[model samples]
Target: MTRSLIVIFTAIVLDAVGIGLIFPILPSLLKDITHAANVLPTIGAMTALYALMQFIFAPVLGALSDRLGRRPVLLISLAGAAVNYLFLAFAPNLTLLFIGRAIAGLTSANISVATAYITDISPEEKRARRFGLFNAMFGLGFIIGPVLGGVLGDHWLRLPFIAAAVLNGANLLLAVFILPESRPGSRETIDLAALNPLKPLRSVLEVKSLLPIVILFFIFSATGEAYGTCWALWGSDAFHWNGLSIGLSLGAFGVCQTFAQALLPGPAVKLLGERAAILVGVAGVSVALTVMAFAGQGWMIFAIMPVFTLGGIGVPALQSLATRQVDENSQGQFQGVLASAVSLASIVAPLGFSSLYFLFREEWPGAIWLSVVAVYALAVPLVLGLRPKAAERASTSRRRGAPENSSGDASGETADLTFRHPRA
Candidate 1:
C-alpha cells in the first residue's frame, strides 16, 4: 500500500483498538465510580455528546485539515485522544469520567481526517474499494479492542484506558514519523467562524443533495452505535454476564463486523452497487437487532451475528456514495456535514433506546429499534433514485461525446432525453 493509505490504516487500527479495549469495561467502571444502578442513560448521553461534538466540529476540523494539512490535524486528534485516555484511566469521580469522554468527543476528528486522507490518495476508479478496505480495518479494531479490553478489564477497570493511551501514543509516534501531508488546497487565513463547532450545520444546509444522505447516514450509523452504546449494560442486565463475558461477546460481534468489512463491501457493491449495498447492509442490521430482541441466549446472537452485522457493507458504502456528491476540493466539508448528521443520530438513538428501556422493559426496546430499522429500510428507494444534477448529467454527456456534442451512438444521443424525462 501507499504511504498515506498505510498511515491512515494504522491510525484507524490504533483508534479502534484503543476504543475496543475500553468500551466493554466502561459501563461497569462507571457504575462502580458513580454508584448509579442504571448507567445506560449516562452512557448514552456521553455517546450522544461525543457524536454531537463531532457533528458540530467535524466541518471545522475538516476545513482545518483542508488549510493546515491532514497530517497536522491528525496529530492533534491523536494527541487529544491520548490525553482523554489518560483522564479516563485516572478518573477519580463520575464528573471526571464525563469530562474525559467530552474531551474525546470534541477532539475525535480521526475518522473525518481519515476520510479526507483516503479521498486524497485514492484513484477515481478504486476510491470506493479502497474506502471499503479502510473501513474493514476499522471494523477489525472494534473486533479486537473489546475482547482485549474485556479480558484486561476483568483484572482492573482502568487497564483498558492505559492500553488505549499507549496505543494512541504509539499512533502519535507513527504519524510523526510516517504519515505524509494530503490536503488539496493551500492554507488561507483561518476562518474563526468555521471552527465554531456548529459550522457543520451551516454546511449541511448549503449542500442540497447532502441532506437526505445525512438522514440516512444517521439511521444507519445509529444502529451500530446503539449496540455499542447499550450492549455492555444490556448483557449484564439480561444474561447476568460479567465484564469478561460482555467483552467476549463484543469481541464476537467485532469479529463478525470485521469479517463483513474485510470481505463484504466489494462483492455487495458488485452485486447491488452502492445504494443497494447500503440497503442490504441496513437490512442485516435490522434483522440482527430484531433477532437479538427475541434472543434468549448469547449463543443465539453468536449463531446469527455475522448474518446481521452487515456493518462492513453498510457504513463504508453509504460514506462512499456521500463522498461522490461533492468534488475533491470540498470533501472535508461534505464529510464534516455527514459526521454532524451521524452525531445527531448518536444522540437520538442511545437516549431514545435507553428511555424506552426504562419506560417499558428490555423486550420493548427491541420493537423501538426495529422501528428504526424499518425507517432506514424505507430510505433505500429514495437514495437509489437520486439522479446526478443537470450540470453533472450534461458534463457526463459531453465526456462521452466530446467531439460532437452528441455521439453517433443511438444510446448517447438518446441519453439527454432521459434527463428531460419527467420525474413522477
Candidate 2:
C-alpha cells in the first residue's frame, strides 16, 4: 500500500479501536456512577447526545477538511479523542461521562475523513475494494478492542479508556510524522455558506439522481441506530442479563461483524450482484430483528446476534454502489451529506425507540424492534428501484479525469466531503 493509504488505514483503526474499547464498558460504568435502576434510558440519552453532536458538527468538520485539508482535521479529531478518553478514564461522576462521550461523538469523524482520503487516492474501479479494506480495518479494531477490554476489565473498569488513550496518542504521533496533505494548497477558501447544512441538502435535492440513494442512507442509518439503541435493553429483559452478558452479546456481534466485513464483501458483490446485495442486506436485517424480538432462550439469543450482524453484509456493497453515482471532487461533499443523513437517523432512532420502550415496556417490551423492522422493510423498494444511469455516467466521466489530491478541496469549493460511495 502507498503511504497515503497506510495513513488513512491507521487513522481508521485508531478511531474504531477507541469506539470499540469504550462502548462495551459504558453501560456498566454508567450504572455504577448514576445508581440508576433502568440503564436503558440512560444509554438512550447518551446515544442521543452523541448522535446530536454528530448531526450538528459532521458537515462542518467535513467542510472544514475540504478547506483546511484532511490531515489537520484528522489530527485535531484524534487529539480531541485522546483528551476525551482521559476524561472518561478519570470521571468522578456520570455527568463527566456524558461530557466525555459528547466530545468523542463530535470529534469522532475520522472515518469520514478517511473515506474522503481513499476517494482522493483511489481509482474508480478500485474504490469498492479499497473501501473493503477500510471495513476490514474497522472489523479488526472491533474484534481486538473488546477482547482487550474484557481482559482489562478484570483489573480495573477504567483500563479500556487508558488503553484507548494510548492508542490514539500513538496514532496522533504517527499521523503528524507520516501523513501528507492530500488536499491541494490552492483550494478554494473555506465557504461559510456551504457549512450550512441546508445548502448541501439543497444541492443534493436539485440532483435528482442522488435522491434515492440519500433516502436509502437515511433508512439504513435509522434501522441500524434503532438496533443499537434497543439491543441491550431487549436482551436484559428477555434473559435477565447483567452487564457482562450484555457485553458478551455485543462482543459476539462485533466478532461476527469482523468476520463478515473481512470475508463477505467480494462474494457478496458477486452473489447478490451489487444492487441485489443492498436489497438483501435490508431484508436480512429486518428478518433477523423480528426474530430477535421473539427469541426466548439463551441459546436462541446467542444465535440471533450473529445472524443479525449478517445484515451488515450490504454495508460495503451499498457504499460501493453509492460511489457509482458521483465524481471525484464531489465525493467528500456527497459523503458529508450521507454521513449527515446517518447522523440524522442517529438523532431520531434512539428517541423514537425510547418512546416505543416507554409505551410498550409493560405490554410488549420488544416493541422498539417493530419500528426497526418496518424501517428496513420500507427501504427495500426505495433502494431497489433506483437505476441511476446518469449518476453513473457522471462518476465515470470524473474518474477519467483523475482528480489530484485525493483529500483536497477544488479551487473554488471549500467544504471537503466524503460519501460512502465516494467514487462518483
Candidate 3:
C-alpha cells in the first residue's frame, strides 16, 4: 500500500471508531438526559435524523469536493467531527444531543468524499483490493469502538465522546500534515445551483444505466441494517444468550468479516470476475442466513460465521464495478449519489426491519435472518442484469466524448478530465 492509502485507511478507521464510540452509550446518554426509561423512540428518531442528514448532505459535500478539492472538504469534515463529539460530551439536554448527532451525520458525509479520494488515487486493477481494505478498516474500527465505548462508558457516560473527540482531533492533524490531494480542484467558478442535494438524485434517475447500480447499493445497505437492528434480539430469543454472549458473537463475526474483506475481494474478483464474485458473496450470505434462520443451537451460529463473512466480499466488488460506470471527472458526484442511496436505505431499513423483527419476536425470532436472505434475493436479478464490463467501458468512453457533465450541464472548465496524484 502507498503512504496515501495508509493515511486514508487510517482516517477511515478513526472515523468508524469515532462513530462507533457513541453506539453503545447513546441510549444510556439519552436516558440520562430525558430521565425516561423508554428511550427507544428517541433513539430511533436520532438514528433516523442522522441518516436523513447524511442523505441530504452527502452529495453536496461530494460535489463540493469535486469543485473545491478532496483535501479541504475532508479537513473541514474531520474538524467538524471533532467539534461535534466535544459538543455531545457536554450536551445537557435532548435537543442539544440531537443537534450534535445531526452535525455528526453531516460530517460523516465525508465518506463520499473519501471514496472519491480513493478512486482518484487507485488504478482500476487495484481498486477492488484497496476497497476491501477500506471496508476492513471500517469493520475493525466498529469492533474496537463498541468494546472501548463499553469500557469507557462504565467509568463515565460522557467519556466515550471525549475519547472520540480526541481520536478525531488526532485524525484531523494527521490529514493536515501527511495527506496529499488525490486530484486537483476545479479552477472554474463554483456553480451555486449545482450544490442542490436533490439535483444529483434527480440526475441519477435520468440515467437508466446507472439506476440499477444505485438500487443495488440501496438493497445491500438495507440488508446490512437488519443485522444491527435485529441481531441482538434474535441472538437472545433464539439461543437465550445474554448481553455478553451477544457481544461476543457479534465481535466474532466482525473479526471474521474484517479478515475476509481484507484478504478476499481482489482474488475473488480475479478468479470469478466482479459479477460472479458478487453472486458468490450473495450466495454465501444467503446460505448462512438460511442456516442461521433454522439454527437450533448457539454453536451453529458460530460454526456458520465463516460463510456469513463471505457477504463482505460483494460490496467491494460492486464498488469497483460502479467506478467503471463513470468517467474520472464525475467520480466524486457519482460516489456522492451512491452514498445518498445508502443513507436513504439506512433511514428506511431500520424501521422496516425492526417492525418485522417485532412481529416475529414472540413466535420465531430466527425468522429475521430469512427476511435478510429474501432481501439478498432481490439483488440477484439486478446483478445478473448488470451490463458487462465491456459494455460499461464502451458507455463510459461514449460519455467521455460528450460535451456535457453527468448531470447534463454544459461541460465547462470544471469538466477537466485529467487526474493528478500529488504523491505516490
Candidate 4:
C-alpha cells in the first residue's frame, strides 16, 4: 500500500526471481560443465556451498544493518547480487561458477536485513498479514522465474543468468531511489564483537526458550531445501519432463502457493491459533507429499498442488509469532539469528536430501518427497510444545515486575524475551 512497502515487496519479488531462475536449468548446466552422467551430487554440493556462505554472513549483514541502517546494507547486497549474476552468466568453468554462486549467497544474506526492515516498519497487528504478502511476493517471483528460466535455457544455458543479472540490477536502482531507511543506525561506536556471526546465535541460545523456535526454523528451512535441490531432477527422472515442463510445474506450484500465502495466513492464525495453524499446514503438506510419492502420472502432481499450497500458511504465522519473542530493539539481531538458522539448514539439508535422492533415483525418484514428509513430521512435537500467546503475555508481565538489568537489554532479564501482545 505504502510506497516503502511496495518497494520492499518488489525487491523481494526480484530476489526470488533471481534465485528461481537457475533452478530449472542448474542440473543441465552442471552436466554441461562437468560432463558427468550424475550431476546430482554436484548440484547438492554447489547448493550447500551457497548456503554455507549465507550461514556465515547473514548475521553479519543483519547486525550491520542494525548498526548502519537497513538501506545501505540492502543497496550493497543488491549490487553484489547483480554483479554475481553477471559473473555467473559468463563463468566458463566449474570453479568460476562456484565462485559466482558463493558470491550470490553472500548477497542473498540481505534477506535477514529485509525481514528486519519489515519488522521495523510494521505494527505487531499487521505483521502477520504483511509477512504473508512478503511470501506472496516471493511466490509471485518464482512464478515468473522458473518459466522464464526454462524458456531462456532452452535457447541458451547462459541466458537465464543474464536475465537474472538485469532483474537484480533494476532491483538495485529501485532501492537506491525509492526505498527509505526504516531505522537509523546507532550513533554508538560499533562493537566489533557484535559482528561475529556466532554472537547473535550464542546470545539467542543463551536464552533457552528461544532454542525451540530456532530449531523449528531450521527444520522448516531444511525441508524447504529439498524442493529446490530435487524438483527438476525428479521431474525429469519420473515424468521424462524437459526444462519447459519442469519450469511450468514449478511455476504452477508458485501460483498456488502465492495465492494461499497472501490470503490464508492471517485468517488461519486468527481461527486456529498459531500452533494449530502450523499443524494444519504440516498435515496438508504431508498428505500432498504422500500423494506425490505414489503419483502414477504427472497430472496427479498438478491436481495435488492446491493441497500442497496449503503448506505455506504456517510460515507467516510462525514468523509473526517469532517476532513476538523479542523486543523491538533486538528484532534485527534476532531475525539475523533466525536467518542464520535457516542458512545452516540449507547447508546441510541439500546435501542430505540430494544424497538420498541419488540413492532413490534409479528405482524410485518419487521417494525423495517421502524423506521430506519425514522431516516435516519432526516439527510437529516442537510446534505443539511452543509457548502460546497467553504464556508469552504472562512472561512479559513477570518480566515487567522484575528489576531492569544493568545492561538495559529488555530481554536480558529473562531467558524468554519480553513479549508484546498485539492490540485486539
How many backbone clashes does every candidate have?
4, 11, 0, 0
Comparison by TM-score, 3 against 4, better one: 3
Name the best candidate (by TM-score): 3
Q: How close is candidate 2 to the true structure, as a TM-score?
A: 0.80
> Model 2 off-target regions past 4 Å?
1-3, 23-45, 90-99, 139-158, 183-186, 241-245, 270-272, 304-310, 361-368, 390-424
Per-residue lDDT of candidate 4, residues 224-264 (tens digit) = 88888799999999999987788778778888989999999
- Number of the candidate with higher lDDT, 1 or 2: 2
lDDT of 1: 0.70
TM-score of each: 0.81, 0.80, 0.92, 0.86
- Least well predicted 10-residue stretch by lDDT in candidate 1: 415-424
Model 2 Cα shift for residue 336 (angstroms): 1.6
Task: Name the 10 consecutive residues with the lowest summed lDDT in model 4.
Answer: 415-424
lDDT of 2 by residue, 1-424 (tens): 8877887787777666766676667778877888887897787778778777776667777767777777888889889988888888999898888899899788775566677778777664466567767777876786677677767866888998888888888878888998888875327776788788667777777676677788888887777666566778877887788888887777787677667666666577655556777676666677777776676676775776666655666777777777656655565666777778888887887678767877777767766777778777788777768764433443444657634333222232222223322223
Residue-level error in angstroms, candidate 3, position 200: 0.8
User: What is the Cα-based TM-score of model 4?
Assistant: 0.86
| Tens-digit lDDT string for candidate 3 (1-424) | 7777877887788777876777899888888899999998998899899999999999999999988899999999999999999999999899999999999899988889999999998866688899899999989998999988999999999998898889889888988998999989999888888788888777776666678889999999999899888999888889999999999999999999999999999998877878998999999999999999999999998999999888889999999888866667778888999999999999999999999999988988888989999999999999999965443443354567745333222323221121121111
Task: Give the lDDT of residue 314 in candidate 1.
Answer: 76
C-alpha root-mean-square deviation, each candidate: 5.6, 5.6, 5.8, 5.2
Worst 10 residues of 2 by lDDT: 407-416
- Go through the candidates in order and give each one's C-alpha lDDT: 0.70, 0.71, 0.86, 0.83
Better by TM-score, candidate 4 or 2: 4
lDDT of 4: 0.83
Alpha-carbon lDDT of model 2: 0.71
